[model samples]
Target: MGRRLIVGTTIDRVDDKSLTENSAAANRTSLWGGRFAGGPSEALARLSVSVQFDWRLAPYDIAGSRAHARVLAGAGLLDPEELGRILAALDDLEAACASGTFRPTVDDEDVHTALERGLLERLGSLGGKLRAGRSRNDQVATDLRLYLRDHARGVAARLVELAEALVEQAGRHVDTAAPGMTHLQHAQPVTFGHWLLAHVQPLLRDLERLRDWDHRTAVSPLGAGALAGSGLPLDPGAVSKELGFRTSFANSMDAVADRDFVAEFLFVTAMIGVHLSRLGEEVVLWTSQEFGWVELDDAFATGSSIMPQKKNADIAELARGKSGRLVGGLVAVLTMLKGLPMTYDRDMQEDKEPAFDAVDTLELLLPALAGMISTMTVRVDRLVAAAPVGFSLATEVADWLVRKGVPFRDAHEITGKLVALCAARDCALDEVSDADLATVSEHLDPSVRDVLSVRSALAARITPGSTGPGPVADQLATAADQLTTWRNWTAESVVPR
Candidate 1:
């Protein structure tokens, strides 16, 4: 029976007889096949195969090969012609990968195995020298770091796009009053822009985590071969420089074993998911008939199959749902690495799928979320109408009393009684008569009516980062500057194609 491999868009079947007949069979079997009498069991092959998902690492693997070939030439392991030939073969492999002409065969267990076969097919015996001082353990670790380092910058850029959308929307609504809530009950009057900027602040922190994570991920692990330092005097630093890494591993064991970088990346991504989910929940609420605070654009929304009037916020709903998958990815990596011993294990192979999943998930999510936010129509009239209801101006009333020389505790009591009176009369605090207010407390002078309006309530919150127009305007400017700085950083740091 033959093993069926999926190479790019084609399926290749390599029989046992063909495996023995082909000179490159050893490349497909195991990089170390001297002791094995036969190929891997069908079950083992099925369990070990990762070329399906890890094929995305092909470019990084090729990049590492090019650098490794140079290091080999420097170490006197390969002649100049051999190094040049190897680099050329790697370049060809990368092109084939890009064109979707090269793919993994079923017998190719992982990307390293698949590429090695491609190299050997291209260079005959000369390609064999490329693996001299490298091991799959080190190769994969280096490739993952390279992959993540590039994608982290991409994620950073996308996050900035999202933040930019928020800031733009906030700028438009700085003067539009909205009801702010605590425990889902109206607690204060705030500008709609303030609420939007709150989401931006957390995204800024997520960007910081990504920048910090990138610093840690920039260390290369190429010279750590199968849990030990390479025996050859090859310069790992040379490979690190070639691959855009800022540094090389200090300890070989730690180099191959450390998946902390992947976990950290996942954690940051999960935190991003959580933050986006919170915003998504708000979007879901705001678009509802009861809230009526915003409406999703037709492009970002979908119609329910059976309902003629249905405009479902499917994008926001998906953003909320996908957050669980992001958290699950982080948890999966942590659990897989928890009991593994020092150095590399087969279990480490499980790391890429979750990490890659988180990346793919966010890559799809962030841009759509940005578009949803950028195009949505904010119902400023509805927000303004709701902002002053539910006794949201109670806090301002208390503050007015405090300004009248009443202690805050007494002021709170007076405001509470006013709120109670309004509730009993089924009226708004502002609708309460001056006589009724004075009966509640002598502090309730005519000046008390000054802060009763929602506009006045928003204006009274003049502290930094408050919901007042001035503070929110300051926040909007700060957000714009911060986003610009991050955008510049992303453009400067992005990995070249």
Candidate 2:
């Protein structure tokens, strides 16, 4: 029940006779080991075990089995009695699995092996007939697609929740100006709302990617055998319809080997992690003592164990850090697929852990990041004061000169000289004297001071996608509409149970 350190180095040393006996014992119970002389030895068994991670797929696996049973009955491979008995056994096994009443043993090499073992326990020799028209290659592929399609909706729903936080916060600060940056230096004034909405844009794209990925993933691979399809009269379309797939496999070999759906899911989740990481970076910086622009609630933050004065943005930090893990998962799966020739290879077994890790990582990370965004407080006074700091409104001065018939290149040079003079005098762009402004450039008039304030600067740029207040308002409305569309999407996607 607790941690224990092992201080021994004795490994299992099996002689040839004992190895043969162990392998022979494994052959009878093992799936697809009958043709071989014996099954895996100790080294192979240790390397071959996959039931541990793959057992989470039991529910989807069971659903696939139910569909397969109906197809088997239709194909006359199983009588009505056998089909009824198989379905009942699967139901019992599924319930047992869900309740922790049954589970994979160490001897079971994979989820398919474990489930077959369970079925054999239930129906004796009749359980063996269930494997007649299917292969683990098709089963695993179908199970993974079903599992991901269900979880994708779940992940997208959480994303919409995060977007809700962003839109809600954006709505409140629609007119509250803050210093926006380029290259981490003050570049212009923008509403805090616009910054929040920027995070949502990427997430909306992620959600859209999930929907698109689902469309490509909706085909069923249940009847695809190891390489080619079966000689039996199994109706893949019937299996597909029962399992809620849009269609069945077009090519059995490709169906058996396809991990494209898993790869696309990894890419989508990795992009989500990147989007969350960017937002996390901003939260860490903005909530720091120097920025003082935002504050996190105690519920969403953490305190250090030894350092009494430390309140840590561990949630944000973890979200930021997990981006690498997500990206690594994508790269790992891609690399695994790069060298595989065709059809089911043992190398493809390496794909599940990384893809599963991506789903688990985002499943845990998204809600916490959303809560952090929702509960954080914006320091309005600090934001407004900092909005025009470092002459962020200097762009307005340049544009003001351009409006007065000054060429942009000449206007740019004049603004640069004025900025240099202000720096030399240790003052702001507007703090330099009117005479100093004229001395800086005759293009400057006292009326050029009109656009110096952050509010004036924000109001001047009223383009649809700009950071100006009216544009920000329009985009906010657009964001709200997008969230509504997302909610409707999650509701309508019909994720499999």
Candidate 3:
């Protein structure tokens, strides 16, 4: 028997028996069954199927199919009636898939196969015409791109929400001081607002990365047939436009083979995970009794089963742990693509799970992280109390000495000796006598004690981006404005799309 396919307004026929025989000898499915004497082995079918994870791409696949049907009609391949019927069938299939009434069957090899089966069931022989001049290779590649583009916008929106939460919390704590650390030891005094704003900056960068990734991912691959350009007169540009893609692929071989977008997205998500993990670590530490800086809301925390007094930071810990998983997702995709040759390969099927899991993990993580941060209780008094401890004012002492015309190296030595005196006497730098201060350096006069107070120490840092009240206020205002811009952008650019 022979089968005919529409190619660029012309009909191309093939000897189905020979093609099927060849494909079956290779243990392919009925979609290429004419030459096949048998289906794939059970183990191979199980191994090759991707419907389990790729089924989430069902809507994108249907969108691509609708566009392809229009192009086919424009090429004079599908009549108006057939095109309308195909589109209607796809709409019905999409509804069923969304409602959970329809799902992939055991024999459905992948999302494409499942949807093709659904279309066939809906339109009977008419559904068979829909596959003309298209290959699963091109179809899947296009669908994955569409899926990522759409979800990347969604992720951006969620990130904006988290950023808003951080900014709001920062505004609430603008005057609340805390001990800032370097190498896990107290280094300086900083407002709680400054600490929170520190996290917001990285999140803004994460949003930028997502936007860049989306820009590169907006190209379509719909007309790349297998590993070569499609034989049909179907317009890849038209399909790209219909699917909201910015451009069509320039090379069919690269179009089908390239997965750099997936890798980039994974990298962006992994970066998001890394940022969140840092924030989570802070939450974990602040909630500890030793720090006593913040308390997690009961709703966002968990109690231990065996320990009666335990209220654990499970959400933050999970956010931290899931960061590793996100990195693993990036590595998995990179490894999968590293050895593949030109064009499509079976290994590409492994790409969906890692990418999908990355999305799932971040989507699950962001809301929880936002809620945890928003609802947590801040111990402002405790923070202020700890802010000036551990000789955090030592730098202020050095700066005061430098202002008094002492060499900076001498000022540093004077401050280090004063810190040692305070340590030996179990007192603060402010408690040192004026006579004791003179022993360190004559520049450390009684008047230098003015900088020992936490408020004075913070006030002295009036430089831009410093923790001074004026600088922090400026930072907070800038953060608020930037956050408003991002939120507006997300609402206008991402949400509607």
Top lDDT model: 1
Score every model by TM-score: 0.94, 0.93, 0.92
Query: Worst 10-residue stretch by lDDT in candidate 3?
Result: 2-11
lDDT of 2 by residue, 112-187 (tens): 8878888898989888888888999999999888878876877888899999999899988989999999999988
What are the Cα lDDT values of the candidates? 0.85, 0.83, 0.82
Query: Which scores higher on TM-score, 2 or 3?
Result: 2
Q: Tell me how far candidate 1 lies from the true structure as C-alpha RMSD in angstroms.
A: 5.1
Residues 292-389, candidate 1: write the lDDT tens digits. Answer: 99989999999977998999888889999999999999999999999999988899988998888888889889999999999999998999999887
Q: In candidate 1, residue 352 scores what lDDT?
A: 90
Tens digits of per-residue lDDT for model 3 on 380-413? 9899989988888889989998998889999888
Error of 3 at 26 (Å): 21
Q: Which RMSD does model 3 reach against the true structure? A: 7.7
The TM-score-based order of candidates, best leading, equals: 1, 2, 3
Clashing pairs in 2: none
| Candidate with best TM-score | 1
Q: What is the lDDT of residue 470 in candidate 2?
A: 90
Q: How displaced is residue 212 in candidate 2, in Å?
A: 1.0
lDDT of 1 at 307: 90
Extract clashing residue pairs from model 3. 8-232, 8-233, 20-34, 20-35, 20-36, 21-34, 21-35, 24-36
